[model samples]
Target: MKWSEISIHTTNEAVEPISNILHEAGASGVVIEDPEELSKEREQVFGEIYQLNPDDYPEEGVIVKAYLPVTSFLGETVDEIKEAINSLVTFNIDIGHNKVTISEVNEEEWATAWKKYYHPVKISEKFTIVPTWETYEKVSSDELIIELDPGMAFGTGTHPTTVMCIQALERTVKAGESVIDVGTGSGVLSIAAALLGAKDVRAFDLDEVAVNSAKLNIELNKVHDVVEVSQNNLLNDVKGTVDVIVANILSEIILLFVEDAFNLVKPGGYFITSGIIQPKKQEVKSALLEAGFEIFETLTMEDWVSFIAKRP
Candidate 1:
C-alpha cells in the first residue's frame, strides 16, 4: 500500500488547530518540527542525544506532517483539508507561510518512520504512556500502562502538558472518586482518572469529532464503563459536584470558564489544569485565585505548566 505524507508549514500558535484539522481529515500521527527546538539547549547529564540535521526543519515557523492512505479521492481530500485550514482565518489565527506539500511513500517506510518517534515513556511514577505497538513491562508492581496510538486528535499522549496532568492525577485521584475532565482531547486525563480508580468520570469536549475520538480512546483504554464521553462547551449544564476536575486545554479556555469550574467542584475537591504555556502561568494562577481556589501545586515540564488547586 502507498501513503500520502501531508506537511503543512504554519506558526506555533496554529499548530494545535491545524493538527486537529489533519486528524479530522483521516490523517494519522502528526509530526511537528519547530525551528526553536534545533537551537534549544538541554542538560547532557540527563539526556544523551544524537545531532539533528538542519535541513529537516523549516528555518521559521513549524511543519506539521501526517500520513494518510493513498486513495482515488486523495486530491479531493487534500482540497478539503486546505479549505478547512484556510477557514482558520476567521478565528484571526496567523497561519505564517501556510505552505502545504504532499509526497508519496510506501506503507512499510511510513510506518517505520513514525514509529521511530514513539516509545514507552514513564511520564509519572505510577503511570506510563506506551504506544499501542510497543511492548512495555511494568517496573513497579502497581505501575499503570496507558496504551495509546497516534492518529487521533493528538499524538500518543506524551506531550508535557498531558504528562503533568497524568502525574497530577496520580497524586490527586482518590479511589472511587468522581472526576470531570473538560476539553478531554484524546481522553488521556479521563482515562488516567478511571485507571486510578475514579468511579464515574465525565469527559467533555466542544468539538463533536473530538468527543467521538475521545470515546474511542476511552474504550481503547478499557475505561468506557467508568469514563463517559460527551460533547459539551466547558462545564456548563454539568450537575453534581465532583471530587476532581481535570482539564488539559488551552490556558485561555481555562480562564474563560474557571468560575464555572469552581462552582462544579465540591469543597476540598481538586482542580487540575494544564496545556498552559510558560508565559501564561501567572495569569492562570491569578484567575484561579480570584475564583476562590487555593493554589495547591504547580508543575512545570519543559516549556509548559500545570496547576492543581483546592476548592475552599
Candidate 2:
C-alpha cells in the first residue's frame, strides 16, 4: 500500500509538543530529528538534517516526518491528506507519484534483511546472544542463551557498543552479586547480567515504554525474580550500593553521572560502561579516574569503546 509522507516543520524547542499535537490529530507515528544527533559536517553533507536555528529558518525550524498509510486513512485522496496535514501544520505539500512506495515484506524476508547485520554474538564464553528468529548452530549447551528481540530501544547485541557492555558485564559480575543497569534500554545487558549469575539486578530507563518492554523481556527470559525493571533516571530513586554497575549510555551522560556511578558501586566493585564513541574514550576514562575509579581494562569495537573500572 502507498503511504503519505507528512513532513512538519517547527522549532527544535517545539518539536516534541508539535509531534504530540500531530499524534493526537491522528498521525500514526512521528520521527523527531535533533540537530545535536548530527555533526556540523554531517549536517552539511546530508541535506536530510534539518537546521533548527531561528536565524536560519526563522519560522519553520523543527522538521518531523510522519507516514500515513494511504489505503488505511485519508481516503487515498491527496486533498483529504493535505487537509489533515494542513490542520496540524502550515506546509506546502508536494504531491508526487512514488513519493511513497509499497514493498512486500514477510517475517522471513524481514529477518533476512536484518541478518546481514545481526549475527550470533558471543557476550562471553558461557553466554551468547542470538536473535529470537535466528538459529545458533555453533552455540554449546554450556553457554547461556539470551534471545534478544531488539524492537525499539537501543540494545540488540548487534551494535558494538552493546556487545562491549555485555562482555564487560560477563567478566565483572559474580554469583550472588547485586547489580544495577542505568539507562537500561531493552534490558538486554541487565537480563544478560542476571543470566550470568547476578543475584539481584535492578534496571532503570528514562522512557516508560522501555521500562514496559524491559519487563516483558525479563519475563520472556524467565528472569522475573532476578531482574527488577523500573522507570527512573540514573538511580535517582534507587538507593544503596551495588557490587557491579553497568551503564551503556552516551559519553556525556556517563560523564554527568560519573560520581554517582562511582558511589553506586561498593569498594572494589566494578563499573562497566559503553556507548562511548572513539573520540570521547579518553574523556570518559578521565571522568572515571577523577571519580576515584581505577581503570581495569578498555575494549574497542568498531567506533565504540567499553571501559571497565573498579571503585577504590
Candidate 3:
C-alpha cells in the first residue's frame, strides 16, 4: 500500500491542535520535528543517547508530519485539515508560516519513519517512556516504564504535554484512588495513573480511533484491568466523582469543561490540565479558579504549560 505524508510548517504553539486535526483525519500518527531539539541540551540519564541530525529538523519554527493512506478522498481530507488548522488562529494561536506540503512514500517507509524519531526517554524522575520496539532496562527499583507505539496511535508519549501530565499524576495520584482521564488519546495518562496505584481509572476519548488506540496501549502496558477505555465526550455522561481528573488537550477545549471537571473531582482531589501553550496559561488559570479550584502547582516544559489544581 502507498502512503502520503502531510507536513505542516508552523510554530510550537500550534503543534498540539494541528496534530489533533491530522489525527481526526485518519492519520496513523504524527511526527514533530522541532529545531529546538537539535540545539537544546538534555540530561542523559540512564545512559540514553539522543542521536539528532540537524538535517532532519526545520531550521526555524516546527514541522509537523503525519501519514495518510493514499485514498480516493485524499484531496478532500487534506482540504478539511488545512481549513481546521487555519481556523485555529481565531483562538489567538500563532500558527507561524502554516505552509503545508504532501508527498508519496512506500509502505515500508511509512511504517518505519516513526522509529527514527522516537526513543526511550525518562520524562520525569519516576516515569520513563519507552517505545514498544526498544529494549530498556529499569534504572531503579521504583522507576516506572511506559511502552508506546507511535505508529499505532499519537506520537510517542514523550510530548511535553504528556510528560507534564504524567509528572502531575505522579505527584497527585494516591494508592487505590480513582482517576478520570479525559481525552486520553493513547491512554498514556490512564496507564500512568494505574501504574501509580490508581485502582480504578476511566479513560475517555470522543474519537473512535483514539478510543481503540487507547485500549490497545492500555492493554499493552498491562493496565487494562485498572483502566477502562471508552468513547465519550469530555466529562459528559461520566458519573461519580474521582480522586483525580487529568486532561491533556488544547486549553480552549479544557476551558469548555472546567466546571464539569471541578464538579467531578472529589473534595481535596486534583485536576491536571496540559496541552496549554504559554500565551493561554493565564486564561486557563483564571477559568480553573473561577470554577472554584485552588491552583496547587504549575508545570512548564519548553513552550507548554500544565496546571495541577485542587478542589478545596
Clash totals for all models, in order? 0, 1, 0
Q: Using TM-score, give the best candidate's number.
A: 3
Give the TM-score comparing model 1 with the true structure, all chains together: 0.83
Task: Give me the overall lDDT of model 2.
Answer: 0.67
> Top lDDT: which candidate number?
3
**lDDT for residue 144 in candidate 3, whole number 0-100:** 94
TM-score of each: 0.83, 0.65, 0.97
2 against 3, candidate with superior lDDT: 3
Which one wins by lDDT: 1 or 2?
1
lDDT (CA) per prediction: 0.84, 0.67, 0.91
lDDT of 2 by residue, 1-312 (tens): 444555555444334334434443444345543343343343121112333344322232445555444454455444444455444333221222212222334444433333333445665556667767777764456778878765433335545576778778878898999999998867888888898899999999877777877887788788999999988888675689999999887666778788888888999899998877666788899999999999999988645689999997
Candidate 1 regions with alpha-carbon error over 4 angstroms = 11-14, 34-61, 69-98, 107-112
List runs of model 3 lying over 4 Å from the truth.
Answer: 44-47
